[model samples]
Target: MPQKNPNPKHKSQNRAGLLRHLNTREVLAMLLKHGGLSRADLTRLTGISGPTITRTVQDLLDAKLVEEGEPSKALLGRPGKMIHLASSKAGVMALVIGQDACEISASGLDGKLQGNLDRFPMPRSYSEFLSLVSQKLKLAKPKNGVKLMGLGVSTPGLFNLLEHKISSCPSIPFLENQMLAKDLEANTGFETFLLQEMHALCLAESIFGESRNLSNFAVIDITHDFGLGVVSNGQQLQGHLGLAGNLGKLPIDKNGATLDAVATDDFFCKTIARLADSKIDIQGAINLFRGGAVDAMNEINLMIDHISTGVATVVNLFNPERIFIIGKLLDAHPDLFVNLLEATRRKSIKASFIGCTITRSKANSRLGAVSAVIGKLTTGKKFSLK
Candidate 1:
């Protein structure tokens, strides 16, 4: 008996099939970006063969992830049929958990919000919090054959993805050590994901906002607490245990005061109160700055100096294409970007400062979390669509 011969052509065919299957995700992502595309357009954009585009688009159509639109007129020969994501087929829920409140919203695959954002006060007890979330999930269920994809949560402090637990949340101590993702999954019978607020913001920016075309960038969230989210080579950096962007821990001064201590809204408010000899909160301080009070300006400059020091370190180390500053202060005072850029340039190297745009994040935490969930679905992650 002759020894069985392995055919090289058979192996090549198998490899080709696998590659086509993988290309399905790429096709879907492109459709999402461009809203719609013809087979020829897809072939040109993705560099895949015309036959492969037809096969991938057919597979997506079979899965109901995409749908066919009206054909386009052609100058010669047959017109082309357009393909686009089926936004009405499925929806995702986003929950943004803050210290005192939580925001929940539902969105479609096209990234358009399905309904109004629902705000709820956060309960102090972990059990109560879980109950509240469960109730909201029940209320957010899709109707008329629309599937519920999954839930994506954005919370403050350190989250350990491997353990599925929140390791630390200084503002909401009750959340520490809680298996939030697992709990949400178990309670709602749907896939759930949890991310640090800053990381979620960065992912949102990369997917739909200012950093969409950027492969490398840093998102600095300066709220009551300072946090950093670094994206390198188009991937969000999550260190061992998912604690990579804990910028609050970065020491800013010789006395070892961290960035969180020196560059937060709370810090600025307290500093203004002390310097101006008046009891004023963050909003009041913002008002004073807007009023052009010399004392308020001086305090803001001091805060910017510390913030610039931290940003300079990030620029020198990461060398990202952009640095996105996000917080109430930046939102209220758009002019701060000018001073921030000046201060950062003074502190950083000339090469580091060049081509690095610093801007404010337009998407709020709620929108960022929603975008994250939509991103997960587009990336072929597992989720419940029930």
Candidate 2:
């Protein structure tokens, strides 16, 4: 068990070590974020000496990590050229997990797509999932020469950041809350990173999606499951065991039904199966909802109320700037948007909570698996202990 309240400052050298760990790209990122700055400015901000910053900047220029630029007038001394990360070269791999299959995406370190994403369906066992992950990485290596930095994986399960183990996850039965890092590295020839699907959603939202400007926000993925991921005060607050924002099992109905029970893919399929007297596609249910099909509408309304209760609980607890709803089905049938919003507002504790926008994920539902793969590719390697 991890000691609670352990300090993170030990590995860092007051400041210089922290700056040193930033790497060439991270240094450039600092400059780009603070606007054009001299090496002296960087040294002062990062606590690294001017000389080290000078050498690192020169190295960056040499490696094309940064490009030369005109000097900014803010420099009191000789107008040194400012530098920034050459976004084109940085890359990452994303691993997206699904109930029935897993997807992989190779992205630039800057989070841009870098390769053709491939899908690998899941087998019933953990070993099979491991084999599938290994096979997918081998199959998806870039033909071009982009060095893979690491692998990042997202799963619909809880993660234990303190122990680096997955504590308990009902969606994925393969992992027994154990550390699979070694097994992953051995199989993929790279360090592996595993994060809760909700946490990864937080990353996507913070960097490139709707939660970009919000200090506190919630991302609810209404897909095969009602998975919820959160960010509070601009930082993700993973619980002691990294199960901070998982709300799928929360009982929202007065009868004590869980959100997953009320609104998951399984619910959708079964509801439609009985309503239509035949199997219905997940996407097809929306059209039926729009057509005023009594049973479909009733189910949709029930789901909205159930979701509203969960969202209300999240809002009352954290009061985020916005709420993002993402899934293959929701994004496609944005026509249901108003009904959801209305239900959420009506059921929420605050009838007048300021500045919360509920929206869908920008990444397409079809791309969920690919995004997961790229997510793993980018983050997996770093979480490994050297």
Candidate 3:
């Protein structure tokens, strides 16, 4: 259906260009991670030759992907020029579509937030959702000639990359079978990517949260629903079916109740209402728990027990360097969080729990989306301003 390239010279030239592009990407990634570095530093860190580093840095400088910073003050020898990512030169847009709301933001490759984050009510239908996102993306575009590199979307579902569609979303059923990334790209004329919300959050944590330097970690996101994301040996584990962290579907009890049914916000609210003998929501339950209500304390303790069971399972299975819990329930109750850690430590193997740290996620869903886009950009994915 397509013509083949017959010119060997053309193919060789293309390969050379691709290799150069990849080298430039490596230089940019180092600048983004460590702030600024001189040519010598890049050569030492990357183990590339000084001449190769010079060529790559010069190419990046000419392309405006990097800019000269303050020169290094070396007392022994001449000061070398410092290079850093051009944080204001270009940016990527991100959309975090949650069950009830959507947040759109644009961020630079250096993980700096560029513009005001826009929030809107999530639409009920798939078409409406796409339209709303398109409109918001336009509003979130950067000003002052800053290039828009691409778009990143974070949603609650299993994204089937081969099929180019979302396979399953319990909270937003209309998303099933929708080619959301493709449609967004077609509508906005920008390269687009999609990530499961938990994966996005885990990426954000790995990049900018408490687990920044940890090589192995797990993130348990417990909100209205539950999900898991794992980073083993410095790589995010997306299973064979892109369903590695679907912990909600895993049975947690002998009766076959899944983690989602037993440990989510809805489950906690219902448990609290039943225990208090009154109709109460999540915020109300938090209020009661904070006030030290006996019934609320008992219900929260039960919740901690269940959550600790899940944590123990993760620790035993993955043996991560740390575990991060993200949710309003854990955020609102510090004491409950401590109790959860203690209970999990009690249940897990002593060796597994020895140096494994468990902490709360610092970034919200919106910032997580931004981090996802930055991640792709640093990995050498193609993008454009137009």
lDDT by residue (213-259, candidate 1, tens digit) is 78999998888778888999977888887767867878777889888
Ranking by lDDT: 1, 3, 2
The lDDT leader among the candidates is 1
| 197-290 per-residue lDDT for model 2 (tens digits) | 7777776666556555578888887776677777888767776766677677788756888887876656766676678776677767656655
lDDT of 1: 0.79
The parts of candidate 3 lying over 4 Å away from their true place are: 1-19, 71-82, 210-215, 254-256, 269-288, 292-295, 381-386
lDDT of each: 0.79, 0.64, 0.78
Clashes of each: 0, 31, 0
lDDT value, candidate 2, whole model: 0.64
Worst 10 residues of 2 by lDDT: 377-386
User: Per-residue lDDT for 142-185 in model 3, tens only?
Assistant: 87878776787888888665566778888899999888878888
Please give the distance, in angstroms, between residue 367's alpha carbon in candidate 1 and its true position after superposition: 3.6
